[model samples]
Target: MSLFRKITETVSKGVSTATEKAQQTVEVTRLHSQISGKRREIEKLYVSMGEAVFRGYLDKDLSRAETKVIPACEEIVAIRGEVEALEERIMQLRNEKECVCGRKVPYDTRFCPSCGHPFPEPAIPAAEDPLEEFDRQETEPSGLSSADPFVEPPGYKDPGEAPSASDWADVGKPVLEEVPSAWSDAGQATPSFLDDADAVGAERADSAKCPGCGTAVGTTAKFCPSCGTPQQ
Candidate 1:
C-alpha cells in the first residue's frame, strides 16, 4: 500500500511539471513570434524608406531625398539593434534551460545540463517615447473682465491709501466735486465782486471803462461802445 502511494505521488508530480512546461513553451513561442513580426514590420519600413530614396535618386532630387530618408534610416537602425539584442537574449535563455533546439523553457532557468549555457540576464528597457506626454498645471482663476483689455485682476491690491474719514465721505460724491480748483468750486465761497461792489465803485470809478475798446460799464449792451469788444 505504501509503495503504491509513493508511485502515485511521483506520477502526479511528473504530470504537473509536464503541464507547466507545456504552457511555458507555448508562451515563449508566442513571445518570439510577436517580436519577429515587429522586427519584420521595422524591416519593411526600412525597405520603403530605401525605395523612396531610390526614387528621389532616380529623379535627381538629392537634398529632398536626404531629408526624407535620414529620419527613417535612423529609426530603422535603432529598431534593428533592439531586435537583435532581444533575439540574442532569448536564445541565451533557451540555451540556459537545457532546451532542445527551438524548444521553449521557463524563464527562471537554473542550468543547461545539455549545452552548459548560462541564464540570460533580463533586459532593461530603454526609455523611449513615440508619443509625448506633457503634464500641464491648471491655471488659477483670475477674476478680470474678459471683454476689457485694461481690466484689473481680481487680486489687485490698491498700492496704498488706508481710507480716512474724508476718503469714505468722498466715495458717493462726483470726482469733479472733490477737485479743489478755484474756478469750479468758486460758487461755494462768496466772490469779492458783489460783496465789495460799493467800495470798489467809490475807489476806481474812472477805471470802469474797458482799456482795450473803451466799453461802457452799464450800457445794457454786452459789446464795447467804440470798437464793439465784449466785456469778458
Candidate 2:
C-alpha cells in the first residue's frame, strides 16, 4: 500500500511539471501568432506597392522592399523556432510522466500494473506535541526521584493485597536464614489424627519439618539454618 502511494505522489509531481510546461506553450503560441500577423501585414504592403506601380503612380524600389519586409519574415521564423522548442519540452514531459494505466508502468513504479491504488499524497509531518516533549525531558537519567532501599515500584504488589513478610526477606536479602524452633508454636507441622485413615500420611509429612525451627524445610536439611537463631 505504501508503495502505491509513492507512485501516486510521483504522478502528481509530473502533472505539476506539465502544468508549467503548458504555460510555456501558451506564451510560445501567442508570440508565434503575433509574428504571423506581422508577416501578413508586410506582404499586404508589398501588394499595395505593386498595384500603385502598375497604375503608373511610382516605380517599385527593390532596396525599399528588402528593408521593409525581410525583418518581419525573420522575426516570424524566430517565433516559429520558439514554438517548436516549447512543443519538444511538452513531449519530453509527457514521456517522463506517469501514465494513468499500469500496463506501461515505469521500472521505478511501486503501484499496481493495472489498478491505481494506495497512491501517496504529499507528506505533512505531524507537529510535535508539547506535552510529550515535556514528558520526555522529565525522564532523563537524573529524572527518577532518589528512593530508599525499602521503597518499591508503584505496583510492586496489587492494590490492597497484603505482601507476605516471609517472601519479602527471601527476596530482599538473598542469604536469609530459616526460622528456628523457638519461633514456632510447635516443633513441627502437627499431625491431625482426627482425619482417621490419613493419619500415617499426615505423620510422614509432619516428620519432614526442620527439627530445630519446626518450619517446613527439605528432608535433607541438616539443621534449622535460615535465621541466625540456633537449631533446637
Candidate 3:
C-alpha cells in the first residue's frame, strides 16, 4: 500500500509540473501573437500616414494632412510602447535578457558569455559642475613669450642703416642718352638720327617741282597753279 501511494504522488507531481510549463508556454505564445498584431497595425498606420504625407507633399501643403498624420503617429508610438512591454514580459517568462549582440543570456548574468558584452551599468547622479569640468584639462605651455624682444628674421636689414654703393650697383639705371626724342628743348643737344630725318624732309621740300609745267610747287601741292597741271 505504501509503495503504490508513493508512485501515485510522484506521477501527480510530474503532471502538475508539465501543466504549469504548458500554461507558461501558452501565455508566451499569446503575448507574441498580440505583439505581432500590434506591429502589423503599426505598419498599416505607417503606410497610411506615409500616403497622406506624400499627398500633402504633392499638394505643396503639409498642414492639411497633419490631422491624419498626427493621430497615426501617436497611435504608432503607443503601439511601439505596448510591443516593448510585451517583449519585456516575454523575456521575464523565458528567464533571459537580450544583449546588444542579439544573444539571449540568463537574467542574472553580468556579461554575455557568448559575445563577452558587458551589460549597462546603473546610472550615477553627477555631482561635479558641468561648467567647471572643462577646467580639469592640462594645457600645453606656449613656446613664445610676451616678454621676449622681437627677433628679426634672416637677411633682414635695419631701416635706419644707409645703403652701400654695391647695393645700388645691382639696381638698373635709365639710359637717357640712348633713347632719342624729336621734342628735345633748344638748350638740350638733339640726337644725330633726329638731325638726319629733319635734313631729309627739308631736301624733299626744296626738290618738289611740277611734272607737267616744270614749275616750282610746294611739297604739299597736288596741282601746279601756274600751269593748271597735275604735279606728281
Candidate 4:
C-alpha cells in the first residue's frame, strides 16, 4: 500500500482502539456501580432480617430474606466477573503491536515487513580487530638498544667524503694523437722507389744492380750506369 494509505489506516486503527477502550472503561464503571448497588441492597436486606428476628419473626423473615438478599449477592458476583473480563481485555489491547504500515505485527518481532522499521536492538560489546591489535603491539618500543640491526653505527657517513683528482688517475680521460699519412713524406709527395719497395723487396723495378760490376742500371739500358757491361 501507499505511504499515505498506510498512515491513514494506522491513524484509524488508533482512534478506534481509543474509542473501544473508552467504551470498556464506561462499561467497567457501570459494572462497579451495579456491584456497589447490589452490596447495598444485600446490607439493607440483612438489617431487615435482623430487625424481623429481634421482633420474634425469624420464621416469617426467612422466606423473604432468601428471595431478596441471595439474588442481590449473585448479581454482585456477576458484575465483578464482568469487570474482570473487561480489565483483561484492556490489558490485551495494551499489549498489541502495530507497524507503521498499519499492519498488526507480533510483539516480539524485530522488524516490520511493510514499513521496514527495525525494533530497538540490545546493546552489545564490539569485537576488536586482531590485525589492528597486532599493529599496535608492533608499534610499542622494546626498550632494548640492540633491537634493530639495520640502524647505522656511529661515525658512519652516507657517501664517505668527496674524491680528489689523484684518486681517479687510473680512470682519467685519455689523450688522442694525430696519425701521419702514408702517401706523404715531410708534407711532400713520396718517391716512386719508396712506393714500389714492397713489390721488389725494397729494390726499384726500373733500377737494377749490375751483377758483374755491382753498378746500378736502368731496365732499358744496354750497359750498366757505372760499369761498361754488355746487355744481357
Candidate 5:
C-alpha cells in the first residue's frame, strides 16, 4: 500500500476504536443505572412483603415466620444498641446528664428545668477520680461556650418553689372586694334588696297621705278615701 493510504487507514481504525470504546462506556453506564433501579425496587418489595407478613400473621398471632421475625428482631436489637452507643457518645461530648425527655442535664441537677421532673442521683464509684469528674462537669456541649442554656445553673431557683417574704409583696396586697351574697342584709349577714322593698312598701302603706289634700289614704286606694283627692 502507498504511504498516504496507510496513514489514512490507520486514522480510520483509530476513530473506529474510539467510537467503540465510547459506545461501550455508554452501555456500561446504562446497565449500572438499571441495576441500581432494580436494587431499589427489590428493597421496596422486601419492605412491603415484611409489612404484609407481619400484619397478616405475626402481628395477629395467627402464625409466626421465624425467618422474617428473627431477622427483624435482630436488626431492631442491633439498631437499639447503635442508638444507645450514639447517645452515650453524645452525652460524653456534651458532658451532660440525660433527662426523661432525652434532654441533657447537669450531674448536680435535682430536677429537669424544662419539664420539672425530678432526677435520680446516680451512684458514684469510690475509685472514680475527682479531677476527671470536675473536668467532665466543666466541659460544655459543642457550639456552646458554657452549660446548656435550657438547663438551670447552680443555686438557681425554680418558679414553682414556695413564695418567700419578698414574693408576698402582692400576697397581702388588697384583693378586689367579693360580690355580696343574695341574702345579705343589715338585719341578716347578707340581706337581699327584696326584703328592704317589702319594708318600704309597708311604711308607705301605713303612713299613706294624699298629695293634693293631705288626706289619709288606704293601702289599696288609688285616691284619698277621705278627701277624694288623687294619691301620688
Candidate 6:
C-alpha cells in the first residue's frame, strides 16, 4: 500500500510540472506577440512621420517639420553615442581594439595586420618631478618690494629735475605754450583766436535755414519766410 501511494505522488508531481511549463510557454508566446505588435506600430509611426516631413518639404515649410524631427534625430544621435561608448567599454574589457581597416586587434598592437596601418602612439603623461614644487618655493621671493623703489622705467623723470627742451625734441614732442590764468593778478585779456571762434559759432547759430525752402531764417523762426511752411 505504501509503494502504491509513492507511485501516485510521483505521477501527480510530474503532471503539475508539465502544466506549469505549458503555462510558461503560453505566456512567453503572448509576450513575443506583444513585442512584435509594438515593433509593427513603431514601423508604422516611422512611415507616418516620414510622410509628414515629405509633405512639409513639398509645401516649402520644412522648418515646422524640423522642429519635431530634429529633437528625435538628436536623441537618436545621443543613443548612438552611448552605444558606441558601450562598445568601446566592451572592447576594453576584451583587451582588444578596432583598427581603421575594420579589423579587431590586440590593444597593444602598433599596426593593423590586415592593412598595415600604423596606430598612433598612446599618450603617456610626462612624469612630475618630485623636487619641482620644493625648488619653486625656494626660488620664489617671499615678500613684496617698497612702494617707491629706485627702478626707473623708460622715459622716467626725477620730480625736482625740470625736463629740458632738447629732451622733448629727442622724443619728437611739441613744447606746450604756457597759458595765462583767467584770475591772475595781471588781469590778462582773453585770447583773440578764442574770441573769433565764439563770434563764428554765434553767426552759425543765428543763420538757421528752413528745411522746406532752404532759405536762411532766424534761429527762433516758426515758419519759412519764402514757402509759408512751418519751420522745425
- Could you give candidate 3's per-residue lDDT for residues 1-232 as a string of tens digits? 4445555897999999999899999999999999999999998998999999999999999887899999999998998999999999999998989978787766755555444566766477879885576555435455778998998999888999999898899689775544424444457765768779999888777767767767656665444545546555
**Model 6, 194: alpha-carbon shift in Å?**
99
Model 4: CA > 4 A from native: 57-232
lDDT of 1 by residue, 1-232 (tens): 4445555897999999999778768767876886788788787877878888888889988676777678877888888777766666656645533344443444554223233344556689988553432322225445666785776889665779475686678677765433322232335755546658877776565445755645444333343434434554
Sequence-dependent TM-score of model 4: 0.26
The predicted structure with the larger TM-score, 5 or 6, is 6
Span of ten consecutive residues with least summed lDDT in model 3: 176-185
Q: How many residue pairs clash in all the candidates, one count each?
A: 0, 9, 0, 0, 6, 0
1-232: candidate 2 lDDT, tens digit per residue: 4435555897999999998889867866765576566667656666765654455434444555555456655765775676556544544544433435523333333333234333344368999999999998877666455673556877487667887876577675566554333222446654444356487677677556544445543344333333212223
Candidates sorted on lDDT, descending = 3, 6, 5, 4, 1, 2
Question: Of the candidates numbered 4 and 6, which has the greater lDDT value?
Answer: 6
Find the candidate with the highest TM-score and give its number.
3
- The candidates, ranked best first by TM-score, are 3, 1, 6, 5, 4, 2
Instruction: Work out the TM-score per prediction.
Output: 0.38, 0.25, 0.47, 0.26, 0.28, 0.33
| Predicted structure with the largest lDDT when compared to the true one | 3
Instruction: Answer with 1 or 2, whichever has the higher lDDT.
Output: 1
Candidate 5 minimal-lDDT segment of 10 residues: 177-186
Global lDDT of model 1: 0.61
lDDT of 6: 0.68
lDDT of 5 by residue, 35-148 (tens): 556556556656855875777674776355555655666665655565566556545544577868776765655555455566665697679888998898778555765554
CA deviation > 4 Å runs, candidate 5: 1-64, 122-232
Q: Lowest-scoring 10 consecutive residues by lDDT in candidate 2?
A: 223-232
- lDDT per residue, candidate 6, 124-180, as tens digits? 999878799789988898676677467788988889998898877769657776554
Count clashing residue pairs in model 1: 0
What are the Cα lDDT values of the candidates? Answer: 0.61, 0.54, 0.77, 0.62, 0.63, 0.68
